[model samples]
Target chain A: MVQIPKTPGPSSPAPRPVPTSADVARLAGVSRATVSYVLNNTTSVRISEPTRRRVHEAAKELGYVPHAAARSLRAGHSRLVLMPAPDFPVGPLYSRFISELQWALGRLDYTVVQFGSVGLHGDEAVRAWAELRPVAVLVPGAGLGPQGVEVLKGSGARAVVTLGSEPVDGAHALLMDHEAVGHCAGSHLHDRGRRRIGVVVPREHGLESFSLPRLKGVRDALHGTTATLTELPLAYAEDSAARLAASWRDLDLDAVFAYNDEYAMLLMRALQDEGVRVPEEVAVIGADDLMLGRLLRPRLSTVHIELPSGRDLAELVDRAVRDPAAAPETHKVLGATVIHRDSS
Target chain B: MVQIPKTPGPSSPAPRPVPTSADVARLAGVSRATVSYVLNNTTSVRISEPTRRRVHEAAKELGYVPHAAARSLRAGHSRLVLMPAPDFPVGPLYSRFISELQWALGRLDYTVVQFGSVGLHGDEAVRAWAELRPVAVLVPGAGLGPQGVEVLKGSGARAVVTLGSEPVDGAHALLMDHEAVGHCAGSHLHDRGRRRIGVVVPREHGLESFSLPRLKGVRDALHGTTATLTELPLAYAEDSAARLAASWRDLDLDAVFAYNDEYAMLLMRALQDEGVRVPEEVAVIGADDLMLGRLLRPRLSTVHIELPSGRDLAELVDRAVRDPAAAPETHKVLGATVIHRDSS
Candidate 1:
């Protein structure tokens, strides 16, 4: 391939001119209001079918699209569905769900906007979100409360959906029982004849909502049996995992249920580096059965979490928005199953 | 241990009332407009210091925050920097960059919104983005052209930044220089006395912009050497990597650049499963040096990329927005370095 010579000038010659709605209206032999009505699809404006067709064709030729902010201002709400910002590095499970959610929302003619509501909690975050007058708000965190929900509703947010371990009052809840995932992992290890199990709890700020509940579930599952539970605080950092694995003998754990596959892979590799045999010395189990985990040496054993499809959730949100008085519904959004592999 | 009976009643009592802007305004003995001006720091609205302080105190007592969407609409642009949606199952490199970008934009009072612009390419995507009237738009894909840039600019977008191998004519380009990344990996393998290298190109949709350019860079660097370049199409899927690794001997490649560490790890584990010796027989290198790469047995060598801080870019966009006539500036925001380890 020939290398293109670097140009010895400014980035571009000049900015290109943009055609306006007025230009399209003029081309279609209609008023600017007619063009706006056709483009914005305002049901209030009655225009002839031929005029609408002409305006649309003219818009296509001129490449004229309605301005979003202007349209939003007129409608008093945006077609944007604001989601709670991810506070931690998203893993495959959350990433895939988010991607699917965006696709689903896009299909519903709603733009998905992810906002990091880390520092702003409860009502402060809700008020901030409400200002956008988003048609819908999907809060993945439990930071939002009943008051927050009311604030969002007052601001014209038609639907409020919260995805967490518990339900929120007055909001559609997509409960992802973290305890069930932990119970699945602990039971799987116990059934495999491993009595001493270590459950990794992420020592990160945002993950507490998930890790804490999961730890409780593990303890609950090991209640009557001789199986023991050990809590291991693991960070996402490699050095942290390495330090933890280097002194694994001191911990005296036979099998470990790493919080998720990402952390599981990290700890497993760290253990291998320290000359510890996996599955033999210490069976490793993880959540979120990612493809990469299976590609590892002594393929990673994981709890496969099947999350509710974004299409289903999106349809529900649309339905809820259309009928705000509809009774709030709760659904189990995440269900886990153990995928047995070489590691466990 | 006792099982907590699942309560059929409400999980928690209704939350206390949240203070609104009107409440703050009333408490401060000021108009709602003045409260908005003081809270949002609108330059056009002149308020006395005493009144501003009173308003601030009232808002603090009430825990009121100015609505983001309302403030944005009144200001004629949302303090939102929209980025093209991320392809899910994102590796550490992109994840780190996104996190950094969000933090940076937050510092500049701009909420970073990740919009999935999939299936919506070029001007169509730009039009969709323009509807939000984001102060700036950052397209991370190669599909955005001059027309797309112009559409954003026409819709009052103050700064349009495109991150890719090639620069868009009307937008300020932050060139990633993928060729350099590829060259760095290829030359390092060559220096290690390996020839007949195969570069793994991801068949994933969003990655083509980076992977294709990296392949060209590898070919360009190996022009005058005995090292012949082999193109290997690899998907992120496990079965795909396994299929490619199953016929590894026929390919006869000594060293392979597996695009990024995620893919490198995938192929490395697959090759090892098929009894191929790494480095000793087939040296392996991946881009986007991640912590997990070093934890692998024999470790994985990788190319590390330093992205321009999101804070710095946010500041630049803010500056550009303040002065729309400021001459557009192109920035080389991506820097690369090789991290040597056991695999290569």
Candidate 2:
């Protein structure tokens, strides 16, 4: 199959001209301004139905699609909600939340865009986002500062929202307190009379934001109790889990909070293979409460994390967009509870 | 936290003017052209290092980031790679592949954007994408037709690459033949002396694209054989699986191909709870060979799917972008094989 070359573009003698509004106007026997109003669906303008039909027909004939970026720049405002793609594997739960958010935003007549910001960080990421001139920006996982919020506002972002552990100044905050997850798991294990406890900290990159807060919460929960917390750094790899399980007895930890269910499953398999009996020898608990966790041999215990509905968040953003003068709202958007099972 | 009102915008007694190149030039004591040259890093035009530093500092002090859309419009080209965010859960395997592709593209200086085309279909989706005027597009999982490719090419997309079941008319193709997965599964089960087989088709939205092809492949595989195939409609819910398992004896199927590992795990659990023995009463197999499948009791057999390396696909795109006149190239990018475990 032969490709239509892009090199001999609008330059080199123009085999086919990229049609413009002016071309549509010429064909429709109307002004370029009229063509613009008709094509853009400008509710503010008044144009005859016949004129609109002619303009559309001419556009179809010329294969013209109005450039969204150019039109947005001209209007000085856009219906764009920009989200920076997380540089981490956020798991299935968070993935579903994002899909919901995108769907809800579309219903509100806003275009959702996930900008690739894999290597970008802090204010550098903010500057990159600002270049797009998105009307709203949703910064995930709490690194946006007051200055970052100010810079985005200066560049015409109507709403700056942050969804993370803590609220940033001058931004709508959806506080997803991850600490509760760790606390729930730690307390549950401690109540089961396990003295020495271990928490799995994944060595995967970009997880430090979630892992550190969770680790801190576990330490806090077991602080005054006789239970001692051990930080076991494990990579999300089979060999790493196997090696950790190999030395499980030497560590003398009676119970462990193995990060989330995926890690728990990996470590659980390794421990069973090593002939360590669960609950009796070493109680294990996980977070996320995946369905597969319940299907495990010991019926895995887990911390069920509840994230705020995406539709609720979208409505909040819509409210902010309508009245940007409204006070920045901070909402508690996370809930964590321990589900007891045979594993603990 | 008080929000800075967006209503009191540029039209209002401006709180702070969104700084432009002119503002940077005024601060740096240079022409707008010189400021543009310095800030945009135009190596074509030589400037003193001190002058470049002055321009950068001036831009920084004024908090100016050149509008990406506006600049691209003026240049008639951009280094933007656009991908439509799939409207379905593409699973962890594809998610990793996407992350890798994004990283590789970013390294090559192209800004990747995932356009939210959640509800749009056919030429409507293509029109929405073309409005952004991306230099390249990587479409996934079949259905992009010849006319759709033409529309995208007409609207300044240099390289149109479809990564799906079959090559499109003019787009460079990455053939992800999902049919092989079902063929492999069907053949394996039939080889194990199982004739009455039930193939699980997930009753999930946006899955028909992959599921239908795989089902066809299975039908083709057991065409002349004594094996009779039954289409099983299964939802991704525990109740749905339980209902199917409850009627398992009545259906009298000896084996099942449960869509993917997740579905297989769900069904297997229900079957076990219903007093049915795996690989005896009902043999089960899944696709996408997840690690969790290995950890399951009696183990789970699965079809291993191999995807083309993101780096390799990225290189292919780069080549097409460089030479759009070249003939469209099609590469088979998916490989499927059976991993025989205890379940089957």
Candidate 3:
């Protein structure tokens, strides 16, 4: 048994030193290159089964793990596929998709980093992200423009995929098409003989990308009809929702399309408190059919969005990064279907 | 005026890289070290005002952004403080706290990296974490043990703080004391003349740390009292909650202390749909007084827990890293108070 060193002096705590390939090599009675070859699973290395077993055992015993950044530096690129921070209030659908994406990336041996570029508005955010040297970046908002795309490309980012309504110049596009989500809700509400629709827009920063397009779709759907779109800017605060619900009669809206299930739930509860009967006084519709919505009394009607699987997206990013020169492609990653419930 | 190179060839898209400190130094007629010192704001540097201004101007003109990882490597520690993945069914309260912490950390010049260690059980998770060599690690769950603590300590992680109900053996403990959250809810229900109280225990894998302790606290609160305790193992899935709510009369529960606001919202909505009157038929209470709870009709009563601000925690970590021998202190980071609302 190899005896590890004792604890350090009282004055100074011993630094936990990571075991290198050399350390593993010494323990396995093999060369450093052999240890690296085995750990990295290099196909060219033709080693005996016993040797491979010895190397594996030594690594496990020594608690030797590969340094991700160091490996990335050596490889001239990282397997890290960074996703720009979700600029808006993320619902369960987005959360689950992100979680799944992380899992998928893990399976593909890529670390997924969520870079919160909140203060970074416009091209500056792209430039800052590029400096990180991520192989691929997935922007989930519309703030990224042509200059931003160029900045990312200039910094060794082989692939930049934007999940938004419009395609970013010089980058692969994964069109989420928020307009479609809005259209699904708008058309459904209109079909149910509801006019004078009130679309709730969040009064928070960074959500404009989603809200603007959705509002546009609502307007587009109501072009020929007598239905007029009213933009109700609502804060996430409970007091704000309560105030709005208290004056619900003054608005005289037949139906309201909340941004998502969260806002819908928020508004619905407030309306109930103010003695406003749902579906009778005001029909309510929301997007992202969250489970909590179904649990509500007179269940929340919603636009169920089926997002492209994160595993598939991760695989696509990997392929794109591996071969950047291969034809740039656009894919529709979000599909919306209206779920009729008691509320609408 | 410096002429920017047009975009590079297909094979090498980033030919003319952004100017480095050396280039900045050349432009400013100063040394590279001086440029670094000026940019980093090192007090030890003795540069005149004019020289500093010149260096700054040169850097600004050339768009010379400092490399984060290089600076970290040179300093022998990363600015990153890794937060271990929270258990599944991470509610809005935790989500908001994390978002706030990230914002606060950014303001303090610390980059927050969240490592999702879900499905990565025990020491393996710790090993996975050590790969990044974060200066500090904040474990938000109870799964990590003494061996895991040792692994982090051994890997140059200066401060290892565990935020959970119990004190972790070798690490600094930020005791959330989740049992107190349960007791707070139970005691409130008891005050409301609730004799038969049921507490929800989520059947999901990672939530055992939180759910079990909460159950114990509820049971402990009712000892020798007229109040009787019942354990309800409920999954986060809607079907499970709906099924449980449908057979409400069979359980004969007067009140329930759902683990958190998220679960409370889930179950309350389900119970309401099953024609159960809230606060009359089943007085429900939840922990983590989320904003949405207040928005609910007959607003959900909750145990509002004030966690130690992330800024304070971040400061503690920085201090601990600087002085490891500073007698390890366990901080009570989480405290519970019942926020009386319409639900109970």
Docking class of 2: acceptable
Off by over 4 Å in 3: A1-35, A46-64, A118-128, A273-275, B1-67, B273-275, B325-327
Number of the top DockQ candidate: 2
Q: Tell me the tens digit of each residue's lDDT in model 1 across B63-126.
A: 5655565566566667778887754346667776777777777777777777776456566677
TM-score of chain A of each: 0.86, 0.92, 0.87
> What is the DockQ score of candidate 2, to 2 decimals?
0.34
Name the top lDDT candidate. 2
lDDT of model 2 at residue B162? Answer: 90
Candidate 2 lDDT by residue in tens digits, B143-169: 589998888877888789998888998
Fnat of candidate 2: 0.37
Consecutive 10-residue window with the lowest summed lDDT within model 2 chain A: A1-10
User: What is candidate 3's DockQ?
Assistant: 0.22
Interface RMSD of 1: 8.0
Candidate 3, residues B61-170, lDDT tens digits: the string is 77676665566656767766777667565666677667776676667666666775545678877877877767788888778888887777666677888888788777
lDDT per residue (tens digit) for residues A85-158 in model 2: 98778788898889888888988988888988877788888888898888899988766899999888877788
In the range A67-127, model 3's lDDT, one tens digit per residue, is 6666665676777677777767676777877788778777887766777565567866776
Ranking by lDDT: 2, 1, 3
By TM-score, the best candidate is 2
